[model samples]
Target chain A: MGKLSKKEIERVASLARIKLDEEEKEKMASELGAVLDYIDKLKEVNTDGVEPIAHITGMENILRKDEPMKKPLEGQAADAAKLVKMAPDSKDNFVKVKAVFGE
Target chain B: MIKDNILIEGEKCTAASKILENYIAPYDATVISNLKQAGAVFLGKTNLDEFAMGATGENSAFGPALNPHDHTRAAGGSSSGSAAAVAADLAVYALGSDTGGSIRAPSAWCGVVGLKPTYGLVSRHGLIAMASSLDQIGPITKTVEDAAIVLNTIAGYDPMDSTSHNGELPDYTANLNKPVKGLKIAVPKEFFSKGLDGQVNNLTQAAIAKLESLGAHIDQVSLPMINFAIATYYIIVSSEVSANLARYDGIRYGRSANKAKSLLDAYLETRAEGLGAEVKRRIMLGTYALSAGYYDAYYLKAQKVRALIKRDFENIFEKYDVIVGPTMPYAAPKLGELGDSLSAYLADIYTAPVNLAGLPAISVPCGQVEVDGSKLPVGFQIIGKHFDEARILQVAHNFEKSRQ
Candidate 1:
């Protein structure tokens, strides 16, 4: 739980695609550090050979058939029309997207 | 108003109905079929934090769900609308997803009963995943009994969700009146620290005292990792969310940017616009945490810490039958007063650790805190060991009945 460096914070922000101001970066660094420092306290516990319990109910390897099925809207113009009708904001037979690549 | 009509009919129950119009259940969601046969009408879809990435209802693309209890305050989310629907009597009960308190936090704020059953007790098939390892669907209802009944219907092994368990299904509602005469309850000391509102603190203490009078043993315990629960939760949840939400590319069911000549541009623009700010923040945080260089430093480390947090509860449960605490540090904050996204994220502090541990925790209205003569409901959370939902319900039902 080392202190989060400025470069690390910037990198994280870049991955998140958020443009953080200096104040925000500093604040996040400090807040994230405090959080990490607190979590670091777990090192004290001895988890020797403790089989990590990912799912609790004790079920494992639930298998299902791997058959490729047609989409619900497949070959049903009515379903496609219904989808278009229900879309909150759609245009030109497609859902719209914001400009990200230098529109 | 539109949501109210839909809930009243008990037909067409499906997630994202308003956006999708039809009751098309997601890949493994069983709630659709279960709700239909139970005579519960599905209202046209209510909005959620896209991919269930938010803790405040404000992250929905459709609109923020107003708290039925205090319209001015936020309804806790990603199960925001579900809680709101129940709070407003829009539905007798509504299903909600809990990955780190989405259901319980909002349930607490909205003054309704929210139950996040033992992880895997409920199926996660139809849920749009935020963090795959941590998500579970449970009921938001007006009464503890309603929650139990809903859990009875939905809690079982589902072949669709690999995470679903095949454990014995107990009749949670049948034991509502069972005497909690000797239940040992632990009250975590870390939960009652500063940042808790005075009124909420007093009300919670009173609730504990009342429970004590009801033949339950209330003891003070320390969950060492409890203070770090939020940070660890965010790191792990965001990382999973980053991966889970990557599937919503424009090529699939969700909206895609058409004008973009290239696939990369399409994905970037579509996600940026479709997702709300909080969703974006989590996705970014997740991506950062899971990235190559930071994986060990952040994501893996969080998992290790998560194990410790789980151990804390496991150790405590060895001595106590159930654990109780204030569901939120304070009652629902004013809707816009959270001011920034970080503040809103912190609202989940009280509820997230239970999710990290994958335990069953329920929020029941314990008392009311009056702010400016407006009575805002406060909740008390009763958490049980993994797969101990029946006992958890018994404890909560006993508390609710005794208070009545």
Candidate 2:
């Protein structure tokens, strides 16, 4: 658990596909390091033979009907469309984007 | 009567009047029907962290919910408006979704009561999803008893929500008057460490002392991994958030791109434009964590860490009836003054582990912290074993009663 380096932050940003400015990368490095440093304190605890409990209630293998159920009407679709239509770049019932795979 | 008329008209204005003006309850969240039938007045949908992505209400597209206590300070969020409404007396209680301290953090900051029930206790059927496994719908109110009342109404099985529990419903309000004599309460040594604000720590200690006077046994317990809860929580939650939010592809629900040159363009453009910066950051982080080469390094390892965190709680609960801590590391920071998104994320450091461990936790206003003659409330967090909210409330209720 060493500190997060500039390269790692850039790698994370690349994987996540968000272009980060230099300042953001620097801030993230420091902030993430502090967080990891804090989390490292967990190593002090002895958790030998303790069964790791993902869910507290001890529930397992929740079974449901395999049959496809009727899709309920989601009232949000029309509203969301209206919202999208209001965006500055929307055109032809679709959202326009910057050119991909350059000309 | 005028207020009642306003509420009735508001309900009629939309199919579900739970959300404030901007948000349409795109789906029939169970809270809608419950609130309508309970005669709970609808006062428009309240603002929240977009898709509940934040701990402070500042993340909402609608606008940051101003803290009623101190307008300049933040109203702790994801459930920001809910807590604000309760504190301002705008609504008796507002429905809030808590994945990791969305409800509790704001409640603590806003001087209200917020409860995150045992993971499966409430149905999340219509509530917007943010990390399915960790999300639980809870109540934010001015009093512990009011929270219990709301919980009683909302807690039950829902076939529509796959993760809902089939367990028998417990009458949460019925235990409000239960005695707290000899109840074992553990105050984790790590919770009171150096970084915690002295004033907030003092207020929390006072609350614990009051509980002790009510015959509850107080002991200092150690939860060393409690510190890692936030980091492990962020990796797992953001990973799930990225996956869950993938459905909003301009085809189904939520804002979608209007004219897509291609299907892929529609997805990227729609998401890029529609989602706020924080949402984008989380999705990207989650996508990266779950990516092919990094999945084992980040997501899988985080899950293992999550297991270790849960084991810590289980071990503590074995000896103590409940664990207590300050809900937030500090009193609500001033609005526009919390500094960065990362700081806001750490605000949940005190609350996220409960979500990761799938336990029940509550935030009750124990006392107020005053800065420069302005006062904001500090909350005492009471966490209990799975499905053990009854005892948690009993202890919290005793503390509340003693304070009065």
Candidate 3:
């Protein structure tokens, strides 16, 4: 519906780097198509000469001085170790990832 | 209590996703830190629609949380478990995020009070981002006063969040008993049109009449642009999701695609295996909307429409102190019953616009509708101007008091 297709979904999923199986892909295609069809209703609205709002706060150029807040961690090093363990693969307090370039 | 996504240190913030099943929050979110400072005890995390993506808890990696009110009905979500727990007396109150009615819908369904504060009124530093521009963490509780208490503790400026507001925080409780006798309340006519169940319409309108009897002046107002809000909301939110969720590759925290063949495969595999069906659908929607060739057509257009929607609310607030409506079109449907994504999204018709407008709104249990001989709670939504949460809270607090 409204130009959304399986091929299109596959293309977008690749861009997001998400791997969808055939079943999930099919379901997503139909669901996304329906959603797009609904949002397509916006075409009727005239947003002529309107400035797009990125944030509702209307605040911009917020800058803060470089200052570090103190952390009085009880067993700080142990806590740091606990946090580091959150990584799926880790070694020596460093998170390990698959090689980027070399095989 | 906690939602699956918001980090609570020493607890797993799985976000009801298999991907983050074992992922303990490395640190507390800013709200958690504030709650801890306020002497709040920590409870275990609860379920939500995966990554706050769905209208019902059915999308959770853990499956839908059963409604405590009726076993067959839903505990309306993405804050499914938060609302469910508080409804079941598992916790006194809980926190929920409203991207598109996540907090308010469930609170309504559970017959409790949930407030979606004006955006940036609360710090977003440690809370996980669903849509950076739309998401606001608020409280789901048993009463409006408790909601105010939570907001008072959590609402303030945080340097860590660039979007955080710098306004002077007010004593939300101070206005809980203030006179609402002369306040102006506008009920948007668009909210009462088709797609709203007739029974819910009557219940919501009767609640408005009750308020009128209590001395608040009420009027029928029209927000012609309301029809465009959900469409605009989905576009902008999904677009932001595509960007925010990209950080979930297998490299760092959360579940990683194990024994990967390549880095590319790792990224795909982890996201593929970790996220649920609803999340993948939204991710694809976001990805396609933000794709190079279509960005202008979908994302930019949506933002422009967002300005119009926001302007509509601002114009209304010029004459009315608050806007009243049904929090949702109907009472919570039976669990596992919202058959499709589009159907579920439609359920948020009345609530999502507030998020798009970036205004403060609250859902309080107003009346019940009998469905198949069983009674379920319905909610009355009251929306206020930006940073004017105190006024709405006072309205809700007084209304709750008046009920007793």
lDDT score at residue A60, model 2, on the 0-100 scale: 80
TM-score of chain A of 3: 0.76
Reference-based lDDT, residue B121, model 2 = 90
Order the candidates by DockQ, highest first.
3, 2, 1
DockQ of each: 0.18, 0.19, 0.60
2 or 3: which has the higher DockQ?
Answer: 3
Which tens-of-lDDT digit does each residue in B1-404 have in candidate 2? Answer: 01110112213211111122223333345655556568765565666777788887887765788889889888887778778888888877777778899889988998888899999898776665779879888888777888888888878777666577887877888888888888899998988888799999999888888888888899998887777777777778888988877765545434555666665566656665666667766776677668779775566666677787787788989999999989998988888877666677777777998898899999999889888678989999999998888888888787888888
Q: Against the unseen true structure, what C-alpha lDDT does each candidate score?
A: 0.73, 0.73, 0.88
RMSD of each: 5.4, 5.5, 2.1
* Cα lDDT tens digits for candidate 3, B363-396: 9998789998779999999999999999999999
Q: Give the winner by DockQ.
A: 3
Q: Provide the TM-score for each candidate, comma-separated.
A: 0.82, 0.83, 0.96
Steric overlap count per candidate: 13, 16, 1
Best by lDDT: 3
Clash count, predicted structure 2 = 16
Which of the numbered candidates is closest to the native, going by highest TM-score? 3
Which stretches in model 2 have alpha-carbon errors above 4 Å?
A1-56, A67-103, B1-23
